[model samples]
Structures are given as structure tokens and as C-alpha cells.
Target: MIMDANTIKDELKKVGISINDIYDLVNTKESYPLAIPVLLDLLQKGIEDVKIKEGIIRALAVKEAIGKASPILIEEYHKIAKDKMMLRWAIGNTIYVTITENDVDSILQIVQDDENGMSRQMFVLALGKVKSEKAEDILIKLLDDEELTPHALEALGRLKSKKAKSKIEILTKHPKSLIKKEAEKALKKIG
Candidate 1:
């Protein structure tokens, strides 16, 4: 059954989460085990506000509820408008925080699409957290993307890509401290 806003609000209220607005339901701290289902329900079937959806995505992450929410989050990621930067960023972060082996291919697809732009940075980092040869290869190639070089360096490091070590070493001398630092860190991880 598709829950109306009032029904969703009532469900949250039963869990002591009194909210005057839907976006107010984005709670990061304090595990609301009772409210998770409601939030998930709302995320799946409730209002269409990108902000509220973004909030729900972030709240789910903070609650460590990604297992139940990951598929829905990925679906939402594809359905949302490209201009919804915050929500896109939230989904990327959710992937980063709760990445699993099953998600490697999906994450690779997202990162490969340059249309997703920098919003895919966290997804790049997520690739590093898992053991995937394809993901490692992609990260190595992404090192050429100036906007994403730091994230690519970090991911390649996490994968301990020996193939990327020489390229990463070059980045250590990059004038930008962030890139240089990421390059140095990746070298350590690769070692």
C-alpha cells in the first residue's frame, strides 16, 4: 500500500519522532530502529521531494540501514534529476559507506558515466573498499581526470594497484597538496 504523507507522519510519531516537515525526518544520530521501516517506506513510496529523499538517504546511512536501503537508493539514484546535487552526493556517500562486493559492477557503471560528473567521486572511493580487478583498472584510468584524481589515487591505493604505483608516484609531486597527499597515502597503502 502506498502510504500517504499523513500515514507516514503518524508512523514516525509512534516512534517519538515528531516532525512538522517531511525533511525534518532526516535523523542521523540516535538509532531509531522503530522508525527505520517507516523511513524506508517513505523513501520507497512517499512524496517526490528530492530534498526529502536526500534526507532519507542520509538518515538511512547514519543509521547503518543501508542493507535494506541500498537497492532502493540505487533505484532512486537513477530516477532523480541530474541537477539534484545533494541527493546525488548522498547516494554516492551511501555507496561509499556500505559498499559490498555485489555493488562493484553497478558502482563501476556509475563511475564510468562521465555524465554523472563529480557526484560519482564517492562511488570511486567505494570501489577501493571492495576487491574487484575491474574496479582497480577503472580507478587507474580515472587518475587522468583532474577533478577526480585525488579520489582515484585513494581508490587505487586501497586496491594496492601495483600498476598504478608509478603514475601515483608522479602525482606525489603535484602542486596541489590534496592530490600530493592522496598520492603519498596511496603509495603507502599500495606498499
Candidate 2:
């Protein structure tokens, strides 16, 4: 049964149902689209609860509702500090899911401005998803970065840029087995 927004809100008010329980229900039923407005409202309320905000972000990501929630997520991203890695990761990933041609420059700027490896990785992954030649070029430059190589390689593969084929072939012999395996996989994908 499809639960309407009002019913979902009413259910949340019940004594026994927790936010987590609601999250599970939403996930199991694949009903996150229905909950987008509610989640956005909760996020906007400044609930001051890290766990709740995290859950809201996760739900948005699962539902692929990032386009609708981008403004709020971007606001939350600015409000968050680099030290809060997990929350930053969640927010970054959500921003990533909504990436578009318009967001490419800003995303690159965020990657350059942020020193956090994890945050940079998420942004690079997002760049890969953009499937633009510019994004492909950026990922190629990042291939030599120890912290970003795996993600960059994965993104390049996702783009299937024939130009990246040679570089990926070189990585096939990398000392790290994981990198080598990923490179080989990316090579196959590019082919």
C-alpha cells in the first residue's frame, strides 16, 4: 500500500515508531520519493541531531532525490566542517547524485578547496558520473594521486573514455593488487 505524505507524518507522530523505523519502512517499500518533502522539512528545521540528519541524507540518496534536495544539501554542506567526515561524506554523496553540467565547476572548486581525502574522493566520483569530457580530463589528472587513484580509475571507467584506455593499461601493472585489478576492469569497460 502506498502511504501518502499525511499518513507518513501521522505515523511518525505515533508513540512507538522511531525515526529509524520510519527510515526502514521507507527503504523497504522504496517510498523515499514520497518522503522527500518531509525529509527536507526535517532537515530545514535544524533538528540539531546528527543521527537524524544523517538518516535524512541517506534516505534522499537512496531515493535519488538529490536534484530536488540539492539546495538544502548544499546549504548543509557549507554549514558543516571538514572535521565532521561522516556527515560531510553523506552530504557530499547526496550532492554528487544530483550533479549536472552546471555543477561541474563548483564541484571542482569544492574538491580543490577541501583538503579532506574522503570528501575529495566523493566529489571525484561525482565528476565521473557527469560523463563530460571535462570531467574525464580531471579524473585522468587524479589517476596519479595515491588517495584518489581508485576512485578516479573507477570514474574513468564509468565514463568509458577511450582516451583513458592507455593510462588504465599502465595501471594494470600497478604494485597494488587492488589497483591492478581495478585498472584491468576499467580497461575492459573502456574497450
User: lDDT for every model?
Assistant: 0.79, 0.72
Which 10 consecutive positions of candidate 2 have the poorest summed lDDT? 1-10
Query: Per-residue alpha-carbon lDDT of model 2 for 86-179, expressed as tens digits?
Result: 8888877877676766777767766665376676778788887786777788788888887778888888888887988888899999999888
For model 2, how big is the CA root-mean-square deviation? 5.4
**Model 2 TM-score, 2 decimals:** 0.79
Model 1 misplacement above 4 A: 1-7, 14-28
How many clashes show up in model 2?
0
Clashes of each: 0, 0
lDDT of 1 by residue, 44-162 (tens): 78556555566667767643564566667777788878887667878989777767787787778888888888888888888888888888889998998887899999888888899
The model with the greatest TM-score is 1
**Could you tell me the TM-score of candidate 1?**
0.84
Error of 1 at 15 (Å): 5.7
In terms of lDDT, the poorest run of 10 residues in model 1 is: 21-30
